[model samples]
Target chain A: QQQVKQSPQSLIVQKGGISIINCAYENTAFDYFPWYQQFPGKGPALLIAIRPDVSEKKEGRFTISFNKSAKQFSLHIMDSQPGDSATYFCAAAKSGANSKLTFGKGITLSVRP
Target chain B: DAGITQSPRHKVTETGTPVTLRCHQTENHRYMYWYRQDPGHGLRLIHYSYGVKDTDKGEVSDGYSVSRSKTEDFLLTLESATSSQTSVYFCAISEGTGGHYGYTFGSGTRLTVV
Candidate 1:
């Protein structure tokens, strides 16, 4: 079973427009939610992360809105740029010493310049 | 760029042959994880090690084995290569347990089995 589910396998947005990607989880034990970005032929890098304690966390132009009760979270990128075009993965994990993260299928985002 | 490196960035091997991939880290992190990435499946953990001489299987570890002799090195071995095992493998390191601080990933190794 896929513990984390992401929507919109692919996305396209014009430069300067906002891009939104959504993900949902079934496990209430998950406490840490993180998003990773991957470029072609490279490893995935941590873009942003949020804990369940906060409803929203923002860093520069990237923001993560999380809903603990709804078991849902979304990533919003303001002023999308061509550089932001890449694959994004949403992951969730319980807080502990040996917890392993469960990742979504991932979404490919393209920004038209 | 957490000083993580994966050797043999690309490899093509024959079926039934044994293959091993290496992950080296200068960061000396406590946790090392091996993950496989396919087209439909984003990333599935095969094995992980929390300390020297300690290892555990992950979500997908049927045809794979791993070893961590030292803190700086983690080795992943395929007992016998299979066509279904053709995928990209990634190695990640975390300073703290459970990766609450996030992980640093190596470039990746693209393994193709014929």
Candidate 2:
């Protein structure tokens, strides 16, 4: 079963515009949520992450808005740029010592200059 | 940054052949994972190792087996290569500071079965 579900298989945004991608999860046991950014011919790198404790977290131009009641999380990019174009993955971690990550299908984001 | 690498970055082999992928970590992280990436399927875990000689299967463990002889190394072996198993494979390490954490992935290995 896919524990996490991400929307917008692909997205397009104008330069300096806001870009948003949403995700939802089914497993309440998962407490850690992280987003990964991947480019062609490279590995997916950690972009940003949020815990259930906080409702929102921001890092530079990237922000993560989380809602525990709805079991959803989203990544928002302020002033999106072409360099930010890539596949974004939202993942949830199964709580415990042997933490396993369950990922979504991924969203390909494109920022047009 | 976590030092993680995968060998045989690219490979091509015939069906029924045996294939093994290696993951090595220099940071000596306590966790290692093997996952395959395919279109529309996201990343499916094949197996993972919590420590040396301790391994467990993941969601997509069929047609694959794993071994962890050392804390820094993990191997995934496919006894009989098939076209269905042709995809990019990635190795990751869970880095934490005594709390919740995320994973650091290697460059990945592209394998093709003819």
Candidate 3:
């Protein structure tokens, strides 16, 4: 079963615009949510993450808005730039001694300058 | 940064052949994972190790086996390679159960079976 679902298979936005990608999870047991950014020929790097306790998290130009009741989370990029063009993946995992991650299909974002 | 490396960045093997992929880590993390990335499939876990000699299967573990003989090395073996198994494999390391801290991934290994 696909535990995590992400929307917008691909996206295109103008530079300095706000780019948003959303994701939903089926497992309520999930306590941690993270977003990863991957460039071509490279590994997926952690961008930002949020727990069920917080409503939102911001790191520089990237932001993660989380809704525990809705079982949903989103990644928002403010002032999106061309350098931000890449594939983004959203993942969820439960808190425990040995928890595994469940990931979404992924979204390809493009920022035109 | 967590140091993780996947060997044979790219490989092509014939059907019915045996293939082994290696994941090496320098951080000595207790958790290690193997995942395959495919178009429209996302990242599916194949196997994971919590400690030396302790391993378990993930969602998509068919046609694959894993061994963790040492704390720093995890091996993924395909007894009989198949074309359907072609995908980019990634190795990830986490200090904890991955909930507290995110995983650090390697560059990935692109494998193709013909």
Q: TM-score winner among the candidates?
A: 1
Docking class of 2: medium
Question: What lDDT tens digits, residue by residue, belong to model 1 across residues B1-114?
Answer: 559999889999999999999999999789999999999889999999999998999999999999999999999999999999999999999888664878889999999999
Candidates ranked, most accurate by DockQ first: 3, 1, 2
User: After superposing candidate 1, which stretches have Cα over 4 Å from the reference?
Assistant: none
lDDT of 1 at A63: 100
Q: What residue runs in model 3 are displaced by over 4 Å at the alpha carbon?
A: none
**Candidate 1 chain A, run of 10 with poorest lDDT:** A93-102
lDDT of 1 at A80: 98
Scored by DockQ, the top model is: 3
TM-score of each: 0.98, 0.96, 0.97
Name every residue pair that clashes in candidate 3.
none
In model 1 chain B, where is the ten-residue run with the lowest total lDDT? B95-104
Clashes of 2: 0
Query: Clashing pairs in model 2?
Result: none
- lDDT tens digits by residue: candidate 2, B14-100: 999999999999988888999999999989889998888989999999999999999889999999999999999999997652126
Model 2 bad stretches (over 4 Å): B96-99
iRMS values in order, in angstroms?
1.0, 2.8, 0.9
Candidate order, TM-score descending: 1, 3, 2
On residues A58-103, what C-alpha lDDT tens digit does candidate 2 reach at each position?
A: 9999999999999999999999999999999999886677878888
